[model samples]
Target: MDHWSSLSMGKNVLMERRERADAARNRQAILRAAEELLRRHPPEQVSVERVASAAGVGKGTVFHRFGSRTGLMLELMTERARELEQAVTEGPPPLGPGAGPAERLVAFFAAVAALAARNGNLMAAHEHAMVTRKSAAEQPREANPIYLFWHRHVSELIAERRPDVDAGQIAHMLLGTLHMEPVASQLRAGQYEGLAASFAAIVRGLMGEE
Candidate 1:
């Protein structure tokens, strides 16, 4: 190519790299701000405007990046669950690999319960936003990456333990419990141990184990 054309292409590439870096920084800042606000206040009090002010970004930027409050909350949930996801993917047994299906399923439930307990406010806000979004859209719930991962994991375990049953539907039922307001309230109240135990019992029954 000509020298001028090569120079213009190089500049465009550099500009794109800078833009990506800036977007990444903005995303992290927004998430951190949102998390802090959720920790300090009730869900209703933590608005996108406040989060934008805290993150030093324009309000429109938040919407542009996340689509809506529900999208932002979902992104935050995904961020918070990253560690648990990694553990399930590659960490030690039970929570990770090399355990029986029942044992692994139990461990996964316990981990999720603990995570919910720790982020009760965030979870509540997410649920509220989700409800609002669902009503406005009047459509199926948006696909959540974290939920998809958990659902896939649960379905695989259920299938491994009981090949005759409908693992996908069962997985949906199991996860549906976690989204219930009562369950979320229990989690926020630090009843994760009981919740986990109850889930374990249910899973055991489903697997035909004593």
Candidate 2:
């Protein structure tokens, strides 16, 4: 159209793009800070000010970006959990489509074992916070999305492998039995090898095979 109209449209596009870019950058900063805190210490120990310092931003910026400490923790863990879930459900893996139940179960446990060993602090921190005070809504539901994802994945495996067995019960048992809490806690305290093997052995038993 006319030059004035074209200039106005161009200006609007530039402004929108700039806002999106800034939002992305701010998100990255917050996540980076959270990740750094996760590496050095648990989430419980990492305050908004600490995260702000780590992210090279103001405390106000962090709060404005994430709204609250819980909000920031959720954002951080959500990214990681969603990645793992997608990997199991959709990404290439023994857990991915086409793999047999036994293989998928084993693979899923293996992945959990690794995640636990690696992210023990983050897990413990979230747990400690949750226990100190329960939220009314529990917006995300059931501790964390990772556990729910694991429940679903393991149940599906059971359904495939042993149609006679109660998949729901199996899911519950696995949720309680081979969960990350105990294993990861032990791992955090420096019992890595045994816990890792124990996880594999447990998975083997679950599969009803050697």
Candidate 3:
């Protein structure tokens, strides 16, 4: 309405935008730090204090942003899945558009396996929580959201290359190997050599190719 009032409102909006941008930047930093820590240490060894220190943020900031350690882990897991989803949907070549169905399937499985390996302990912690719920009725009846998404992607790729095969079942089989627990087990067992190639071989085998 008035000049000063309008100017004040505009300044307030700009301040709000700046705060949101800063918050987003801080969140990304924390996630990056947490991922690095998880790579170097087990999930139990990671903590809000450590993540905040590694990210160069205040402990209160970590708590304020994520609420708790479990909350942070869940957000990190979701963020990792979101990144993969974005890559497959919009990223380059094999993971995105332009590659043949077989190529895409191989790339997709490899990417998924890599993501799972990186987030292994964090995800396995979540899976343990899911199973240890007091009430089985309160647990999710459907598959984990990330798993369902991968399953759908794999199924679509399989359908494109081999429509006659049981895409759904075959997708499930491939994904079983890519699960966080299984991949983490393999990695811990020092069996990560040529992991991506193994995933490709499995995909090719599922496609009934030589």
The top-ranked prediction according to lDDT is: 1
TM-score of each: 0.89, 0.80, 0.69
For every candidate in turn, the CA RMSD to the true structure comes to: 2.2, 3.0, 4.1
Query: How do the residues 1-210 of candidate 1 rate in per-residue lDDT, one tens digit apiece?
Result: 999999999999999999999999999999999999998999978888999999999999999998888888988988889999999999999999999999999999999999999999998888778766744653234267888899999999999989999999999999999878899889877689999999999999999888
Which 10-residue window in model 2 sums to the lowest lDDT? 132-141
lDDT of 2 by residue, 1-210 (tens): 999999999999999999999888988987887788878876678877888888888898887887667667767767777767878768775857777777777777667666656666766655555555455554443556666777877887888777888987878776564335666567566455665566567767767878
Q: Which pairs in model 1 have colliding backbones?
A: none
- Top TM-score prediction, candidate number: 1
Which of the predicted structures, 1 or 3, would earn the higher lDDT when compared with the native?
A: 1
Number of clashing pairs per prediction, in order: 0, 0, 0
Tell me the TM-score of model 2: 0.80
Which is superior by TM-score, 1 or 3? 1
Q: Which is better, 2 or 3, measured by TM-score?
A: 2
Global CA lDDT computed for model 3? 0.77
Residue 196 in model 1: lDDT: 94
Tens-digit lDDT track of model 3 for 1-210? 999999999999999999999999999999999888877886666778899999999999998997766667777888878988998999997999889888998888677667766656776655554554445444251365766788888899999989898999988877666455666687544455477888888778867776
All candidates' lDDT scores?
0.90, 0.72, 0.77
